[model samples]
Target: EAAKVRLADGQGREIACDGVLLTGQFTPESSLGRQSHLQLDSGSDGPKIDQYGRCSDPAYFAAGNLLRPIETAGWSYREGRRIGSLMALALCNQLPAPHDALTLKYAAPIKLGVPGRLVRGELAGLQHIQLRVSRAVSGTLRVRAQGLDLWSRPVSALPERRLLIPLKELQLPEHLDQLDICID
Candidate 1:
């Protein structure tokens, strides 16, 4: 079976594949929170929350993608578990006021991808990029300014290839707390 979705441009198209995969982007769907008179802050790439996973409203709490856009599934599960514990304590009247430091330290832009490039002379070939994780599950990728890297399993084992192109990390003002990727 096929499915078709009308785009904002009013163009018509249909997918001939048997299955479709959807990716999550940063689009705040906090209408419920807003309608309920809860404080809303769309300043960050994701929803704003204190360390305890509490939203602007003391009674309302949030977790997962609703709070922040994390690429790894492991981080989402951890956040969910933490929020659950906090909610349970709040319900039992055993938890104190929430603290941001106590909340999980989430790494922004969990995934990075680079595109293939060709240069001349010594820099003609592609540079070898490597990611070294400081923690068991955390790491940094070292690559040239412009280079391409793959981030998917073998095609024979996986139907699609996930390519991760490397770009430079930017230094933002101290006031900002999130990472932003600017692709040229």
Candidate 2:
């Protein structure tokens, strides 16, 4: 089982594969907003939006992967809900509250590879890799892995006095040694 990939004229080509999974990249499709004179912030690969889902233009707003590039669908839905609320409040002429983005702290997906022999270990035979996450500080999220401790850390610190957890990531740590293992 072998696969070959080729690129020509900035296009991709694939050949000789028993099974091929084609996935499309997340592309910002703000053409409608652009046509409506909305200012889109293309700072990164995806469209840029404020914490409140407000685009560069006040009249326009965005959400989901189109607004910001995120790997998880859970985050996208949460963003949509937050943006929807902001839009509704704005249209109602009521002083819309500020939007505070939530931090998504989850373990990275496990990678699958060919099976290999385990040499001299407490547990023998096939072994699995796991990710561990814990709370180091009161408001900080730390991620750790097997044989590693706290490689990545994200601060859930918010600027506003009010606490709004757009998603579960904003929730306080459950335990001292709790590892959040999210498959896909």
Candidate 3:
């Protein structure tokens, strides 16, 4: 016969609540990507892709919440439309295959970074790189390649919200195996 529940915080604070409802633990469903043998991004637990959304197989492309997870409907819709157009171009042989691409490397508390790979020549249309953090953080987010600072900005982010890094001013080196995204 419990009328209420008491929750204790790490800082020694306690709160009484009628109930606790926990949510937002959604993970992208990637069984199909697995069965299809597409390269998987451990960060998003989805198919790894380039800025244009081309997956490991040149014939396969993925987009939207399927690549991330549980974004707003509007975001998913826009992403679908954008990637759909790219798919059409690919079908017509107008889209260039991913080359000169750099793999993205990030550590906690960065939960994920969209466009798991970045293509140098094909980056013109990509406006921003979306990111999600595993927890709350406030610091300067930086992107580095070939020991050079490609981009940096101060950010305050929470787990439930998506963060965007604009690519308009970003520049990467011609010869780099990976790009590092970090917060410091």
Q: Is 2 or 3 the stronger prediction by lDDT?
A: 3
Candidate 3: count the clashes.
0
lDDT per residue, candidate 2, 1-184, as tens digits? 7566667667666576697776543345555665665544432223334344555454766665564332357755765776687687668855233232222224322211011111122211112211221222223333333323433343333211111222222222323333332332
Instruction: Please provide, for model 3 over 33-87, each residue's C-alpha lDDT reduced to its tens digit, 9 standing for 90 to 100.
Output: 9788789899888899888889987789888777887788898888888888888
Q: What residue runs in model 3 are displaced by over 4 Å at the alpha carbon? A: 1-22
> Against the hidden true structure, what lDDT does model 1 obtain?
0.39
For model 3 the local lDDT of residue 67 reads 88
Off by over 4 Å in 1: 1-26, 44-47, 69-74, 98-184
Residues 56-132 of candidate 1: C-alpha lDDT, one tens digit per residue: 55586776556433334675587578778878767886644533111111122222211111111111111221111
- Report the number of clashing residue pairs per model: 11, 0, 0
Q: Residue 31 error for model 2, in Å?
A: 2.8
Each prediction's Cα lDDT score?
A: 0.39, 0.38, 0.81
The most accurate candidate by TM-score is 3
Q: What is the clash count of model 1?
A: 11
Clash total of candidate 2: 0
Give me the candidate number with maximum lDDT: 3
